[model samples]
Target: MPIIDTHCHLDNIQYQDDVDTVIQTALNEGIEAILIPGADPKDLPRAKMLAEKYPEVYFAAGVHPYDCENYDLDILKTYITHPKCIAVGECGLDYFRLPEDEIEKAENIALQKKIFIDQINFAKDVKKPLIVHIRDASDDSKTILMQHNAKEVGGVLHCFNASEHLLPLSEHNFYFSVGGVITFKNAKKLVDILPKIPLNKLIVETDGPYLTPHPFRGTRNEPKYTNNVVTKISEILSMSKSEVSKLTTENAKKLFKEFDIKN
Candidate 1:
């Protein structure tokens, strides 16, 4: 069985010249495929191009919450339904850095909710899954997702660090994407919480260009190092490396399919 990087930004500008090496590293690492998540409209075209270049790279198209604050989805919406755009997201709310003014929070939440609903319905209408990005706004994210009937077109909370108690959000139907952070000594809270998640509800990622795991910590991350994520998840679950690899690879194919992949 081969590993699958469930979430990574191989489309990031940092990889332009070195992409081939990065991808080759994935292949050599027994990584069978990757879901290159689009961070914003600016990255979607490059994401599609990279997916086309790599036989194993699939992609999604949508705006990240941080970047989506000033969005004009109409333009991106047209191209979002393209064949290579298998999902709509990396989109959601981020109240972590925002002020707690009720009015301000409400306004941002409203905007986030609108985009989330729009993207969910677009995903439902276009017939694709979603790739969600939620940070410090888990409550709002869950609330709006439920209100929009997000379960109709299921997705994942990519690069998640929420508590185990919040796993019920997946009950409404979503997978939890675990990344390299779970391996760190300082992430004991997350590590202690993650094993409680059932294997079927989990997916692995690098979220690269970030979250480099231990030993490799403090360095830039990439899809090639997604194995570090799997290795740690395997340790937490007390499962074999091959088990985690096979299960997550199947999990990835189940959520997002592509022509190049023999789904």
Candidate 2:
């Protein structure tokens, strides 16, 4: 039952009061490791601290699309050098919440693309894998990734939205990270696409503090809940739970290439 939550936000305020307990519970449940993504510059320190405090914890250094407005490459570069920083993102295009004003929306899209491209280049420069986050901007995201030759360093599309258009990325060294959303009733699209994703490129995430799996949707998400994700994936792929766990854990290690699973 060894598992790795490749994208939980342990730095989120939701876990401020009891992150230790949450992490220990995850460990007790057989989640071997957790990677906190850097969505906010303010949280990178906290993420780093947690990674230092717990051997099972690691983190990525990059801003989310929603937080691109505050993007600062120099600031992110500092965290990129940390020994515990495993990847370069959670960064990419997100068009789900563009402004109503056409002009403002256009400007916003441009900024996100700029930030996204900058981060991609930065990842390449640092020679680290990326943890991409693409939403309604799939077309743009795929185009940018291809145009920029992101395959050089490789990466994972965190919370992969099941857009068939992005499937070709598999050939370019990209992996797809499925999260708790797969357990939802409306995840038919993702469920169907799951089998299509090359098993070698498949990994799992909780995306904790958000997208909590069923049987606990409204409650705050935590790394411990990755069990539900593994269960649903096993059912969807018709594989044993341990098989899913082993394969995904290996996929994560192959991509992140930072920490090793401790016995």
Candidate 3:
């Protein structure tokens, strides 16, 4: 079963010096494709180049929430139209790194939300699925997206962190994606919810260069570890690892059909 990493940042500096080796390793482990998102302007070109150079790689172009101080939506829209770009995101609300001062907190979040909304609009215009990256702001993110009528070809809440409150987003055509965190010791809640979530609406990712699975939590994360995540999620859902990989790969392909990735 070939796994698809739906949210790995292969263009990041963490893998810049060894991209060829990192990608080769993922192939060695049966990781067939990856969605490499450009979180910052400086990394956008890299994301495109990597996707173009590698047949199995695709790009998601957007400016991340944390770095939304001075964003240019027009440029984002322009760059995202490149043939290699398949989605618009890795963008969403992030309260984890907000300023310590209480007064500035609201402003920071507001700015992030504004940027997120703009990107959502861009996604709608381009008709490409979105890739959300919510961090400690799920409720707000859901509220805003819902209010804006996000159902217009809704996307996935990638690398989901909580399982208690399933983000009833499918009504909006959205799906939830899981990653290495589900394989952690303290993820019993997620494990319990795994079997409950609709399989067709579920997708798996690695978010590589970060969130490495349990067995290699402290080690540098890479796409090759996507297998461990698939194994863990499959066990939680009482299915074979191959089954999980197959479904998730299909889900990823359906979401990013522009790439023509055959599962």
Cα lDDT, all candidates: 0.78, 0.92, 0.83
Candidate 1 lDDT, 134-235, residue by residue in tens: 777777677778888888878888845565645887777688888888878888877887877767778788898788888898888988787888888888
Off by over 4 Å in 2: none
lDDT of 2 by residue, 109-168 (tens): 999999999988999999999999988888999999999999999999995578988999
Give a tens-digit lDDT track for model 3, residues 160-259.
5674454577667888888888988988867877776778888888888888998998988999988999999878778899999999888877878875
**Could you give the candidate ranking by lDDT, starting with the highest?**
2, 3, 1
Pairs of colliding residues, candidate 3: none
TM-score of 2: 0.98
- The C-alpha stretches of model 1 lying farther than 4 A from their native spots are 99-106, 259-263
Candidate 3 to truth, TM: 0.95
What's the lDDT for residue 94 in model 2?
86
In model 3, where is the ten-residue run with the lowest total lDDT? 159-168
> Which 10-residue span in candidate 1 carries the lowest summed lDDT?
254-263
TM-score of every candidate: 0.92, 0.98, 0.95
